[model samples]
Target: MGASARMRLQLQPPAIMAEVERLLAGRTRDIRLKGELRRLFQERSWPRTAKIIRAWMTWVIMLDALTLGLNAVLLPRAIALSMILPACILPPAALASAFVWTKPRAFWLQRLSITGGMFFILMSVALVGVGAGGEFYERHLNIMLFVATTAIIIFAVPLRWTLTVAAMALGLYLFFQLHNPRLETGSAVAATLFFASGIIATVVARRTMNILAQKTFLLELRDRSRVAELADANARLERLARTDPLTGIANRRWMMETLHRLWSDGMKGRDAAMLMCDIDDFKSLNDRLGHAEGDRCLVKVAGIIQSSVRRNRDHVARYGGEEFLVVLPGADEREAAHIAERIRQGVEAASLPNPASRVAPYVTLSIGVAAQAPDDAIASPEQLQHRADAALYLAKQAGRNRVVLHRPDPPGS
Candidate 1:
């Protein structure tokens, strides 16, 4: 095949995978789910892998030391000691690598330390194998050690690092075999079989771990999305509960709670006020103009009351049919009266024609203003509301289209 054609064939798989990734990313927005998946995998798996690698390294180092001590009796003192010295340094370095693994960002350093340590340990054992003898016993023992160490490295470390350590150990093994002419063909074949088995084991273990990690990432993303959707649903429910469906103002439940809060503040030395407003002769207006116009009238009055009370702490609610309650948190009697007068005038100015009966030709409001001083002895939200209602009755009785201040009942009357 031509070089260009060969190159295109080689590039096709990666190009197809890239296109698939792009399509998935476009569907999922700019969040880079694949990148997040990888990050989550690292975060979740790295610590456990580090711990396993550390434990395996410790065991291997100790075993190497013990083996060196045993071989010392059979081999030359110089050769055995040469092996023992390098083996002695490995366990401490392995333990230090465990410490490095505890740092989240030091994963690469930890991997490097672990892979490098395994490479050196295998290389040191290979050195001993070369120097000891060219006999069958020595070759067999070294081959077993190489196979065992390869298995440990592959099983303990992640895929990329395992491949690296395996490559280095295999290279060192080949180098040793090349230098030793006395090594038999059968032993070489056996060593090749062992390396192949380790490679297969590594591939199987790594693939299994990657599959599990991907499943975990997908499950976590689904759970996060569900939680977010639940939170939004709850917020919408809360808004619906607090708002009046007809006029779109605060509902009675929200207004009562707000009034109780204001009462608490009033007890703590802040004056507050309440304005209980009713549409002037609303029943006749509803009967004459139809309930639809009545509903529109309520919505318009609610808007006017909401707009008239400019203070952020002031709250307005549809108290009941044809009635609204305004709570001003810090307003005293004079300020309360002024706000109520403004609401009354605002309703009159709207000039919604009420051609039925006694009030004005246009729609009007009778607002009852009730102010509470910090020291006033009104002990309950009911009492406060009652005082405003009483004033509202007086405003209706004294003719509509005006604000009336609450006058508390005379003592013991």
Candidate 2:
């Protein structure tokens, strides 16, 4: 119907507006049944609520005191202080204090408090007409003081609150001015000026808050984006560190770290086995296929070996260019040998296309298996890997593609 409403309707298509209306109707069902505003207020942060409570308390106590004091002292004798200007000072002071304690930060609170104190001092000037016999109705000092008070309110309170207070004060002042024109004209004019000033101040305050909220939101979004970027970088670094560049298996570093851990536990008498494997004729394969093909072949072999070991504690890793290692906790030499053989068979079964083969098969592996023993001389992870490597050499020498189990040297030897 209205221009703004028509603009909004154009922005939202008929279907979208229908959906929005449905959602609003659904939400309003709950609103229509609600009377829990007090409970909602109670849930506000404690310090914020405490500041608001202090404002109301200050208003009650200070306003009544100022009214009584004006009646008793300033209004009565019209002493050095003409009709108490505190009647105007009291409300502004209370409102100023409210602004102080409810300030967003401690720094602003101090600023507002100083403003309130200065306002009170300037308001005391209302006593200039003291000893001038004037009816309370004929008080120009109070009118001037009220104008100053409105200026104080514009600076002290936030926009919405300022507007509300100004509007209320203006309405009452206008009503009184209508009833008692001769007496209330000056004060009425002062009130109107303040009301206009309060409206402007309120607009400025709302604009400032909107700007601050926008900046804060953007800052939070930027921080979250930075965190997400850091997380992605860390994940990429971890993958690079742990994985083999050539074969895509866990690298030697991961293998050594795991074997070191297993060996340490073995020193405490925990059972674990290691299987060291080498691709037989791997040097020949490199000579036959280019380095690229060799790398692809190795990756394929690594996949086969990894699949052969199934236990939770079984770990397979790339030891070197054509070598791999496995750590099998709770496995003896025989069980480790069986796993090695299975891996060997799986590789042999691959039957890859080989143009340059001395033997008929494309690929095969030589595997050496060894188990940790508390009584063994292997005291460290290096010693464990050394023994497995030695066994692997023995397997390569014995035959191209067979599993070999490590046996301790004779005691005398």
Candidate closest to the true structure, highest TM-score:
1
Q: Whole-model lDDT, candidate 1?
A: 0.70
Deviating ranges (above 4 Å) for candidate 1 = 1-77, 80-168, 174-182, 258-270, 310-312, 349-358
RMSD, each candidate, Å?
Answer: 9.9, 13.2
Q: What TM-score do all the candidates reach, one by one?
A: 0.67, 0.57
TM-score of 2: 0.57
lDDT of 1 by residue, 1-413 (tens): 34553333233334444543454445332323344345444655665676676666667667767787787888777766655655565566556665666656565676777667666666655665565554733573455456545544345445566677666766666566655677676776677667767666766666565555555444554444456568789999998999999999999999877766766755532576788999988999999999999999999999999999965778899999999998877689999999999999899999997898597788999988888755577536676678888899999999988899998667899
Q: How does model 2 fare in lDDT? A: 0.60
Clashing pairs in 1: none
